[model samples]
Target: MRVRVATTILGITAALLAVPACSTDTAPPARTEKPAEAARQAAPLSSATLETRLLDESDLGEGYLRKPERPSQHNDVTVIGCPSLSELGGDAATGGTLSFPRNAKADFTYGGSSSEVSEELYSDNAAKLSHGIDRIFDATTSCPTYQVLAGGTPIDMASQELPAPRGLGDEQWSQLLTFSTGDRSTVVKQTAIRDGSLLLIVSGSPALVDRHLDKALAKATTTS
Candidate 1:
């Protein structure tokens, strides 16, 4: 599975954590309850509103420092040797991650530690929000193990589906990704949860993501 396939576009920074996580073996289908999600839909919030809701240095408490937000940019990542993705066509870019018109994000570092965590919020119609995360999860199953070419550098990537944090939202998707190039390996955990028209994506070191997942979600769903 792609452990921290972090280039994930959600964070563009997911794979906009910006990130995506995975393992080596095939992953199961993402779990979603479409009918239930639609029934609970909340009015989609604007980007400005989501910005106010973004988790800040204080939200993460002590030891976690907010990193400067990077401007969103186009990613030219290409996936190689994934037959299913190839069959789907137009699915090549971003290794299956996506972007949205109304979104806000933040990145953070823990003390001086090199490890970081990220939060991304997306607001759109329910269908688009659901589809956005679904595409990334789809890649985990279709390209369990594949090669990613980032700036002409060959990166070996693998992904394994992780169980979503149960009952976090109307629907959820989770995975772990491992990115390797030579002796270096990075593991990232990505979990995307949606409530109404809002989608919250969190990615980074597995433990940190787990620690902050609930907090991030709570903030995103709170009514203004």
Candidate 2:
């Protein structure tokens, strides 16, 4: 069975928002660009614009096909069967999300292969957006190893930090996850890029993510 990993981060913002307001930890430094300037630099993406920028079936090689687009109203983490975002942190809403899937179905013992390109745009102020990203980064540091139950089967997932790819966005961080069950294993790589006010997430196999990075960046630049 193919597992759906897109819904993982919906509740993360809410959970993260639950954190006590009096915490003494300092927020990450503000970006050189002001919020208003960043917003002006990249206008928010419309549904129509997003559809045009999504990678088409022809973009992937033979055996790879484009799945229907199912955009969400929240961000996603890599956990397959996570029950709640509080497991990660925060209790308030965060951002809007859009996902494009390119899948390869195989009859092998393990489930078929799949990949996704997701974009999250934070409508909140720059401080909130930066704070949200910072919280995500900090959360990843503590939960390196975790498990989620998919269809009653426990899926083992592991997370590791990856250096950002060059020249794509203002700031970037990646999470490499390995999901395994029995003899079947899948590698889901996710890279998050903060370009102006948009958080572009590329997820799938490492090769797939790499292949789409430049295209994603180019399209993101045209978000006016």
Most accurate candidate by lDDT: 1
RMSD of each: 4.8, 10.9
Model 1 Cα RMSD, 1 decimal: 4.8
Can you write out model 1's per-residue Cα lDDT over 153-200, one digit (the tens) per residue?
777877777767777888888887777768766778778888889989
- The top-ranked prediction according to TM-score is 1
> What value does the lDDT take at residue 117 in candidate 2?
36
Residue 102 local lDDT, model 2: 20
Measured by TM-score, how close is model 2 to the native structure? Answer: 0.59
Error of 1 at 21 (Å): 12
Off by over 4 Å in 1: 1-35, 87-92, 95-97
